[model samples]
Target: MGKVTGFLEFERLEEGYEPVEQRLKSYKEFVIGLTPAEAKIQGARCMDCGTPFCNNGCPVNNIIPDFNDLVYKQDWQNAITVLHSTNNFPEFTGRICPAPCEAACVINVNGDAVGIKSIEHAIIDKAWAEGWVQPQPAAVKTGKKVAIVGGGPAGLAAAQQLARAGHDVTVFEKNDKVGGLLRYGIPDFKMDKSHIDRRMAQLAAEGVVFRTNVVVGEWPQGSKVTNWAKEQVSAESLKAEFDAIVLTGGSEQSRDLPVPGRDLAGIHFAMELLPQQNRVNHGGQVENAISATGKHVIVIGGGDTGSDCVGTSNRHGALSVTQFEVMPQPPVEENRPLTWPYWPMKLRTSSSHEEGCVREFAISTKEFIGENGKVTGLKTVRVEFKDGKLVEVPGSEQDYKADLVLLAMGFVNPVASVLESFGVSKDARGNAKATTEAEGGYKTNVAKVFTAGDMRRGQSLVVWAIREGRQAARAVDEFLMGATSLPR
Candidate 1:
């Protein structure tokens, strides 16, 4: 601990944000990070709590206390060194993670938790500025070949570890770039693509080959999985060529709302709308790109994707934006005694929601009203839970005006074709079946094949994906050489 009484003297300081009016005009990150002095103060807030729950709370198991102590002592270089030891990409998580580690902070039991995410953001940004973030190429070549499918956070993390372990690693991506969901699913306003770009440069320098615009399996025809791949590489080719294969392909099956007007022109899955916006930002064009400009828009599903839709709609200058959540709104404040030291359920208003949005909770859409093959409005009803069953209110049925509707109700599983092509059996939830045990972790039913991230565990946080990727990399390395030097 840097300061004995720092927690008593200091309150949590969050990172600053650009004004709504100024930031809404463009698709750029508007967060103002903390200065070095401010970060030192935040780091000092970390008490000498005997048990560091924040480390276990973090998906990547970051050494939070060490980094806090380093930052407090003004040892900026060592701060990043400790950070990178467990987490491969602090910059990505620092910017976008919801900070479950903060929830698990021991200080949070009685006061505001230490600003760990903000401190991490500061540390990584500083490391980059000082040119401390550099390529760590392997000292010797192991002469083994590895193929990583999908280039999202998980895939990238696995690739970096395998490459640094002296394996010939090649990442196969279906998009025009390496970042899977990070590059396309997330809007640029949340995190600019430059972060992924610089990391790609570092990975390439570390001898990780990236094969972009290459699909490892057949993309279902007329699917809305948001692929920009130009070429298809057979699964057989990868199996025969690579010494080991890791499936980091993300959950791409967008759950659909099979209502009456699902065939309407203006109704679409969130993936279709989100990726197009990212493509546009990258100086690419989408044929008949879905636009929310000047139209009454409705976003279904109250998750992160739905909030993103609200933000994008606001940026697009929509007439009105409304979001629907089938579940009732959670308490604004959680019952800390019941849920402390773990992620708590509470009302979460994203920066996008703060921008502007009408949020409807405990509501469900019944039907989509349309005219001339295009959506015009929605029929809805208030809902309540009785005996754990959802029941619609008898008199609450109504219609609301809407021209564009985006379904953001999360993904169900990875594209089945990719898993089937590898002959990998699926779990009950359709995710690739691979245990997380150290002895046979990430190994699929098929020999020489492994799975990680969303492909194995279903859709989850980016931090969890990164953790799985790193663990899977070690699993593959050990399987190849009978022992792995890479960190667990």
Candidate 2:
């Protein structure tokens, strides 16, 4: 606590955003971060509760109060250190994470919660601007070798930790660069790719080797690929080379709507559309890229991915945009007392929606209409919830014109070939069969193999991915050295 009554003295201040009209002209990050003074005041709002539920609330278990006090007292360097003690990348989480910590804040019980995410964002950004962030290479080599598949957050976090433990670590990415979904799935307008680039530099300086454009599984002819390895390497070869392997590949299989006109030319998955723009941003050529420019676009599935589609379409100069959600809209305000310290069901309007979007709830697409094998419009119907089940209304059907349709229904599981190649077992949900037990956590039935992240737990937040990566690294270290000092 900076002052005895700091929480009472200071009012909450949130970060500002660029005007929607101006931001819609281009695909770029628009949320402005807090300044030093503003962040300090926000830090003062932390209650320093006897039992900080915020720690348990955050998937990464960040030390909230300690860092808050540090920032309030002008010890920014130490604040960053405290933050890095638990979280591997606050910058990534600060921008994209949904901030479950705020929901768990004690101040949230009566008034506005402490802006923990904003303070974190400020601290890390300041550390980078001051050139305080550096690579901490291990002083001695353990002579242990580790191999990581997939360059997503989970794999990257595990690789970074393992490298710091003095193990010879190598990361394999099928694409031309690192960051699995973070690189391609997420639109750069929310988080620029430069964040990943800077972290890549740090990881490289810390002795982690990266090999991109090398698909681990079988690549069939005519398969979409950025680049290829001169000599293909099999799962058996990887097992032979490294002492241990961690399968942290994300869930890549997208759920599809098998309605009529499924083979229409203009209908595509959100992954197919989002990745093309990322490729263009990376200076790669994409022939006839999918654009909503001057076209009426309809995005099915109302989630983060769908919101991303909405943002991207607006930036592409779309004539009109509409989003569909199968479930009925939630209440604008949550029941605070009932949902305290837990995530509540409520309506969340993202900045992308503000840019320009017609959000429709309790709507179902009946069919896709096409002409000349190209999608032209969709037939839809309204529905209502009854006894916890949705029932379509008989006479509430409608039609809407659309040139582009993006399926953002979310992923099902990782590519089956990747897991099958390793002979790893899968859970009922099609994820890698593994537990988080400290004694035998992340260990696969196959010798010296482990799994984590979406590969192990299915689709989840980036913060949880980092937590799994750190824990999986600890488990791998213990398996190799009989014991380890890395945090679980």
Candidate 3:
């Protein structure tokens, strides 16, 4: 709204990345953010639509047009204030969120949408550089104590909100550090760990106590959530110690491909490979670390996790790399007229895909062929969609060499032991059975125990997790005090 016709005058200016060759040399962030002038031009492109569907498009409901105008006017401090009003962590979302807001832009109906993500990136970076971001500790104590299991985004968000509301909040993580998946599952190249470190400092200053290396469940905990906690604690002990307990653990169980030779030595989950590299990157000791060098790696699953594996493998100097998808390939571009405000189905070639990968769609893994208990190859078949079901074609069989097979087919549910410890009910999908409805929302069958995020809603985006945490905190506050002022 700054220039009135700014949308017509300026075209979209995408963020740039370092060359692939240069980036692969080390594990560092590569995206170069926009300058102040370039960011202002992009912010001016906001049309300030009457409806502002971008608000609905964004999971956190960030005030888009308001911040856009602030940025366009060079009011960077105010711009970041507006941006942080809704989103707890603009820096995290600015770097990795898929930017559904851009898809919901009104101008996108005809031409390009405003670069909302880049503008957000600019605002936050400028805010940090100017020391505008600071802690907001509560002035008085409510004297009520709350315990949060898991130190991921969801748990952290809930902790921050409750702490700011004057509640004594403590976060229990089983790992050597906090940040959940953000600390380990995510590579430093995509987003450095320093962002998490800064947020940890802010949360600490806000009076959130963090207890690491304290597992809440039994063995068989392997995901990032499990790694956050070191030793197990019983549910009875947590219930007796805290006024309220919120379970926000992630779905750490990786889905497996149980085919022939499934127990071979060279096959592993993406979680196992990704976390080792992260520990190494953090200067932690990781004996027998997984590597892709001098190997023909085949990653099963075509989602973001697989793409991450692809990037890591390329960096490891893998001899060859290929990615497999069970579904048919989507069109390069979506029919925008039909899919405009909603996320559309289209071929998404990620930065890792660009690094180097032989992407194959409509392929299904049949079996893992191995020699002397080590993976040597895999049998696959072509697949087609028929009557809303995947039908495998009998004669379209093939085989490929694979020195290492990575299963990145997504997670199933949280580890069962944690839920069992609390006797929490689970939905058909194996996630916690806590409705988001107004009455008893986030409240489990257990009296004082609550659930949110991936633990309650199954696997989802980080933004959605933050939303769940905030909402759950509100619910917990109301349950404890019979009234509350926390935002939903």
Name the candidate that leads on lDDT: 1
Ranking the candidates on lDDT from highest down gives: 1, 2, 3
Question: Which pairs clash inside model 3?
Answer: 173-228, 173-229, 174-228, 174-229, 174-230, 175-228, 175-229, 213-230, 214-230, 215-231
- Kindly indicate the candidate among 1 and 2 with the higher lDDT: 1
Which stretch of 10 consecutive residues in model 3 shows the poorest summed lDDT?
221-230
Q: What is the TM-score of each predicted model, taking all chains together?
A: 0.99, 0.98, 0.97
Top candidate by TM-score: 1
Please write out the lDDT profile of model 1 over residues 1-488, one tens digit for every residue: 89999988988999999999999999999999999999999999999999999999999999999999899999999999999999999999999999999999999987899999999999999999999999999999999999999999999999999999999999998888888889988889889999999999999999999998887877678854444667889999999999999999999899999988889899998998988899999899789999999999999999999999999999999999999999999999898889999999999999999999999999999999999999999999999999999999899998999999999999999989999999999999999999999989999999999999999999999999999999999999999999998998
Candidate 1 wrongly placed segments (more than 4 Å): 224-227
Clashes by residue pair, model 1: none
What is each predicted model's overall lDDT from 0 to 1? 0.94, 0.91, 0.90
Give the count of colliding residue pairs in each prediction.
0, 0, 10
Local accuracy of candidate 3 as per-residue lDDT tens digits, 119-224? 9998998999999999999998999999999899999999999999999999988789898888878888988999999999999999999998998856563555
